[model samples]
Target: MILLISPEQTDDIEIKTLHQLFEAGLEHFHFRKPNATLDEHRAYLEQIDPTYYPYIMTHNFPVELTQEYAIKGIHLEERKWREQGAALETYVKSFTDKGFAVSSSYHEPEDLAAQPVTFAYHLLSPVFAAISKSDMQGRGFDVRDIPKFIAGMGGINAQTTPEAVKLGFQGVGALGGVWNAKDPIQAFKEMQSAFAKAYNKKI
Candidate 1:
């Protein structure tokens, strides 16, 4: 899987680029805008072609937004899932019952392994030095033994995508690697091509 994460902030050019990426066959789009309000998020989705709604996974207001739009599913940020405590399974089931996917983020492999509620997939970060945040150091996590469908985040780009695959990541998630590129569309295609070459399967 090749997951593309949204930048924290939005811009007109980014929106246009997003449409182009969707057309270019972006499958998993994590719509994460931490500071955007619900209305703002809705507005952003409205700008995109509705046909790509099935490829989107919102990071905020999962319950509200998923009900209103035919988005792929919801994502539980680390804090949100941790805060669920004993209610995590029930929360996930609520969406699963609706035939929507529910994924979550984790910082540690052990924490992800011990997670009781089975998410559609799990996101583990800082596998390499982060491109979006310079201060965060890379952990170089190797999940080869983990049985879960874990996607490696942090410092992922065309160059490091094959490395992540070799490290046993079932997927790769990118933010800065694509958004920070001189050409986001070409950057995405490069990552896809690199991933396919490494995994021996098209994403």
Candidate 2:
């Protein structure tokens, strides 16, 4: 499953929470800290169990760090997408040379047109009214609106993950739904079970 680390700060509790998530069968992690400094991010990384999860750094941070940690890949935010999209050939070649897979956020169809650089995947969002951000709209996408080469994020959890899969998402990512749960392990199991149910039902 995809576990998105949207911690406000690199605090002790956040680190502990991340460790728990990693232990709970999460292998894909997205570190999308938009306001953190390089030092702050480094400090957070220091707290994580490097061997367990394929930690993906946001484009705002230094890409070199991923190589240093031997992480799976990097999450290309808007900036990286625009910058790399301009030179897709060179960008893909260099990153692939380093054995790094690429993932990025896509909120629109226009974004899809620009993608073909051998990215491992993409994340589309706000599939439901997310508890973390109640004011944010769920983008009104049901099972019919999903795109190929994409996973669903934003407010996704045990309850909605099944619906997300039915809508054509290959995987699901979570934030407050899992992290803010009264019992994270239970939440993880529920989400995992929901995904399994969807997969089995399809077969």
Best by TM-score: 1
Q: Model 2, 159-178: lDDT tens per residue? A: 88888878777778787787
Question: What tens digits encode model 1's per-residue C-alpha lDDT throughout 1-203?
Answer: 89999999998698899989988879999999999999999999998889999999999989889999999999998999999899999989999999999999999999999998999999999999999999988899999999999999999999999999999999999999999999999999999999989988524
* Candidate that scores best on lDDT: 1
Local distance difference test, each candidate: 0.94, 0.70
Residue pairs with colliding backbones in model 1 are none
**Cα lDDT, model 2, residue 128:** 74
Whole-structure CA lDDT of model 2: 0.70
RMSD of each: 1.5, 2.4
Q: Candidate 2 at 34: error in angstroms?
A: 1.4
